[model samples]
Target: MLRRFPTPLLVALCALTLTLVGTAPVSAAPTSAAPSNQARQLNQTILYYDSSRAAEYSSAVSSAVDVWNASVGNVRLEPAASGQHAEIRIITDDGWPRAHLGPVRPGGQVTVWMGRQGTAEGYDAVRIAAHELGHSLGLPDTKSGPCSSLMSGSTGGVNCTNAAPNASERSRVEANYGRGPAGESAADGRLLVDRR
Candidate 1:
């Protein structure tokens, strides 16, 4: 024969059991930590460019986009979809290449002028495209910097042709985009002309 506990005792035991279980520690699953690490990459800011008006410089623009995409993790550059308005516009002109400096936000507008003069003067087309795009990414001209620095522009000379951004330039672009869209400011809209 089994003995039955009093109703009051049974209730007390039930409450105690629930309290103990409720207070038990939970160890996080390994996967739970993965999202934090992946979040930044998953949230990478994307800026689109319209090269339709760039004319003969389209391939050069594409190559410059490739260089930037390979160098940074916080933002990505992609061709604008048909009928979609792009944040960056590439156009060809007879003058020197220039870009409206911007850490351009999504839906914002900035122009990159791919001037024929630069190519005519023997500067690498890819280098001119990359340098102008760098201005769109918020990089200023480091006119005195060596050829290894993509922002050095025409000062790197016609033979320079180094279309890749150096470590510091990459880091600055990464930091600019990492701040997300809300961090955008009017001051980022300066026009950078790549003369000389």
Candidate 2:
């Protein structure tokens, strides 16, 4: 439901979305300090790469996912598709939109365009991925940064990343959505992982 992309975003041809459909938690937060309406959402990590760069793209995804697993709640990257209903999936979309990045249903799927890997080398590192995921965690952007600061709008070559949501980031989302809901969920998405 929350959708806002900066001007001049990526121009991808094919992008996938992962949404979470769940009921409200049994122990809702006290009305005084919570977003009046709660939603069931999932977090998705997407990495678009060129077909030639596919081999090493996974290493990046794993590196990023590891960080999320250790700090964020317990959400895992759904396996690559095997013809079933996958919450997280990867597709060979000629060109997915690049501006597509944000929160998801914690265990939902995101299509990382494998077609745009090389362009990511000089820029877009684990930090960028983490920061984006932070958004999924319900954090917002600062529109500025120290370059290494993940919240900064400056893209690429800025390896600077700090996924530990800042006070403002944490307070803003939790203000609406409750504390991390059970991270246990399902996504129907094919992770472009381990493909040679």
Model 1 residue 33 CA deviation in Å: 6.8
Q: Per-residue alpha-carbon lDDT of model 1 for 13-74, expressed as tens digits?
A: 99999999888866655778888879977778899999999999999999999999999988
Candidates' lDDT values, in order? 0.88, 0.39
TM-score of each: 0.80, 0.42
TM-score (C-alpha, index-matched) for candidate 1: 0.80
RMSD of each: 10.9, 22.4
Off by over 4 Å in 2: 1-55, 74-81, 84-102, 106-110, 114-121, 135-140, 153-196
The top-ranked prediction according to lDDT is 1
Question: What is residue 181's positional error in candidate 1, in angstroms?
Answer: 11
Residue pairs with backbone overlap in model 1: none
